[model samples]
Target chain A: MSEAVLSIRNLTVEIPTRGGILRPVDQINYDINRGEILGIVGESGAGKSMAGNAVIGLLNRPAKITGGEIWLNGTRIDQLEGEDMRRLRGKHIGMVFQDPLTSLNPLLRIGDQLTETMLEHLDISRDKARKRAAAALDEVGIPAAAQRLDSYPHEFSGGMRQRVVIALALCAEPSLIIADEPTTALDVSVQAQIIALLKRLCRDRGTAVMLITHDMGVIAETADRVAVMYAGRLAELGNVRDVVTHPEHPYTDGLMGSTPLASKGLKRLRQISGSMPRLTAMPEGCAFHPRCEFAQDICRAEPRPKLNGGRSACHFPIQQPAEETA
Target chain B: MAMIQVKNLTRIFDVSKPWLNRVIERLPKAMLTAVSDVSFDVEERTVYSLVGESGSGKSTIGKMAVGLLKPTDGSVLINDIDLSRETDGGKLDKARSDIQMIFQDPYASLNPRWRVREIINEPVSARGGNVVGLAEKLLEQVGLSSLDADKFPHEFSGGQRQRICIARALASEPKLIVCDEPTSALDVSVQAQVLNLMSDLQENLGLTYLFISHDLTVVQHISDKIGVLYLGRLVEEATPDELFENPKHPYSQMLLAAAPKMDGFGREIDPPQGEIPDPINPPTGCAFHPRCPIATAKCSAERPEMRVVRGARVACHLAE
Candidate 1:
């Protein structure tokens, strides 16, 4: 995959709950090449965010990566601890959360936040960091970057505030970014603006992005490759266009059909009848077998079946050759 | 005849601080014209949706529709009963029972301390009716078992809670329900399930809905008639088929184009330009003229009123 910038191999995240040891993310594997946008799509509690968090080593308390390795540019990082991981975070990897306000300190000026992150990672003077911070703001399409440096987060609008957050994330010059629902809080019109800004900035800098979201439309618009997760497992993974138009896994297919965009002229949406299984109550064979429309007797008794490639984990995946012509 | 008629409805929020603070800052009294002179009609048994971004006054309009918030100006007539001017208690009570509301966040709307039974039966018991039998029936009608009435809201998922919200709204036997961003907080798959249930309920019970949301795709899927709002104004109103196929207003066109669609995969879309102006000090004429791609001098100089054009109401100086 042309020297993968980020490679996740056999990743698993576990939580020691009162009921039992809960595996939120189970043995997921994927790769993001330089400048590539890999989108992870799933419903709530699908462990899409957990996998991203595992890569950044920011898993919340009571949840830790129990198995597998995270490789960043030929270096193993998941085993690193404390200061090593902290240093690697701002220097090698950056993160953008759903809420901009949470990532940013409301009391400090936007410029201060950007400069602080930059100075921590790079061997640069305060003056140089200040200049670079302004440049970063301008790069993210923020108007009057020089003057805006003095402005606090409250002074800016929601969309502008998110832009500032992105500028802060980019100021460190990290090779990879983990954006978890970066535009979910933004308005639809403003959402388009932020997505375009992110895409352009990442392209020009050749930085890889791991975009975790529940919106398939966002994935279709921005991602190079798409990975579909269901009940803490990878259901399907392929090129964005193929996965979107012709999903290999039935879960992905049901997800696409459930979206309002795909329900045109249809009386009722093609719905996946039940909710995702609780971690403690996961089904015996396939996690999605209970809701699968094409489920057979074998599907309930056997674990996920291997496809010709690692593109799908379904017992009877949607045939590919027929999809190409249709 | 329209089931609910809102005529020149306007709501203004005084967002200024105390009088002393205004005087100290040498600032005039700040007021936000949330919904300004907006007018529309909801036909019985039909879904009328208001689509717009935040601060466009769609939710404020919804609050006014259900009498949760009184308008600073204009009138709301529900089934010929004017909500503002109704002095007769009997008529006002009937109007209140005929209309109900479903909020955006199912988590916050339902009482945490109350069981599902108490939550659903509030409307029925408020009017001195038997809540036990009605609660059981509503729980089943919303696709949950009658036993679920004894459980708490935390026990259910987001989709199930929304179904409970729907059941509570139906308990009053309301003819009109105001749904404010009902499915926006939900995941796409669960959103579909709830939408399907809502559509079914409408068909079976002859319910009229005022659906408000920011997502154009969901609005298009659920709406019979759709209204596009921007900066407290109804910029366009038309049937979903007519509007989505060919939007008349520039703002409407921009909204349709900017909405991320699954069909046009890998195509680079031109993002919508510019931020929405501050409502406290909005642009003089058309609020959207500053960002409109096809703006003329007339658009900046004077506001455009709604005009009938090709079976739709469009508010743009250049709209034909």
Candidate 2:
């Protein structure tokens, strides 16, 4: 088997607030193999993005990684600080953010941006980088890539701009890409194109991807494995088909039920009643107990259960494993 | 009779540069046809959804329907009264009162400084109607506590804010509410809640909805009739079941095929051919012809008018 490109172990991130220390990302564990896409699915404030930000060392002040380790290509990187982390970002870990407009510099030409990233991370001549930049754009399905190289960011449409963003993220040829809601701002057709582009590029390059999104459909289509996060904890983790088809965690189940499927006719969507709990006012045991229908006394009394050689972090999961069922 | 009738609605925006700049650049006056001769009717208490990509004029049509913007040509009639042409002040005012609009962003739509009470009651009080306790009543109706009327908008979550927006839309007791991408900004769970709430409200109050959205699943879930818009033109219209099951228009087919699905595991679809054409200078005949997979000489030389193809109204020459 191919080695894990990125391995996260017992990762925890905390924000120090006047109210209390909010663990936005609780102790979570996962790994992404070469050419695999691991989808982190959750609601807002569920710490999916926080987990990604923690890995890329982009966590803002007041929020810091308090525990655990992040290993990239067999190197322990959790303690890497400032210059070292900055250098590692573009060279090894590429990022695709939700908004293409903000992710790119409005003032620079698309070609120059790509070449600059390539020149910074790679040992290549200016002329070589420029040619490679155009090739990268062409590879991303940009029309007239050579001509578009001179155009400013504002000159391109939203979908084309996103393609440029993907090109920029890939020009350096990082081994792992952290895409946080990459298709959220795009139209459906454009989104499909972008997802396909990302998938094809990553697979061809054998780049591991950590795809963080709230949309299950995107995950279902693009991801190889799935991680369901709730209240800053890994609620469930398994193969995409298994988790999506039979969600063990109630939160995961509720999320699947809530997303209106096109194949399903006009049936009332099964909404998980109540919103996600605030960090300041988190529930006693499981953060999802209040909204979860199967909550018991133990769910409210004890701390949230941990995933100990199990697929889900629940006292009573909705689905048992095949061996357990057998 | 239909509750809302939009007939040959056309809106053009002057997208030309400033006169001096245009002269310097030697550029002609650029006109963007935002909504082009589009027509649809919303029956009383039914949901008619307009689904399209950005720059397809779904929001523009929504704005025109709710009288937020006047059409450059054509008319929008609410309850059989032409909102733009009716000169009778009393009749126009009555017609206007029967119509209200719910915007996409709950955060940006509501005033930041006002209390929920004032925010919800503004519609009634602006016209010198009885505003006392109206906010509280609507709050309860939208599943919020009556006491929340006194609180500020900041205190509530996104879903709650949307519910507040819904409550405000209902303050005037509008018969037709044009909701433009109402649940797009929300998470899926919250979106489901809001959708269910809107459906319940529509059924209970007999409200007619002109729903505009980019999400096909949401539109399919809620709409009685769905219209597929491409480059400011209504390309197809059909019931949700028929549209989803068998879309006639190529654009509609592409949209359905492109939309990500939960059950679509490892499904390989060719990346849709091209981006939505520049709206300012759309293709000569069918604007979608440029990106259409099965485009022919006829598709480019002459536009196709809406004709009933099977059970759906499709505007594609090849659709039989």
Q: Which segments of candidate 1 are over 4 A away from where they belong?
A: A306-309, A321-326
The TM-score of the first chain in every model comes to 0.97, 0.96
Q: What value does the lDDT take at residue A3 in candidate 2?
A: 98
Q: How many pairs collide in each candidate, listed in order?
A: 0, 0
> What is the TM-score (0 to 1) of candidate 2?
0.98
Model 1, position A151: C-alpha lDDT score: 94
Write model 1 residue lDDT over A1-326, tens digit each, in one string.
34899998888999998998999998888999999999999999999999998999889989999999999999999999999999999998988899987788999999899999988999999999999999999999899999999999999888998999889888899999999999999998898898998899889999999999998889999999999998888999999998998888999999999998999989888787889999999887788998988989888885556443578998888877864767
Model 2's DockQ score: 0.78
Model 1 per-residue lDDT at A115 = 94
Interface RMSD of 1: 1.0
What's the alpha carbon RMSD for model 2? 1.6
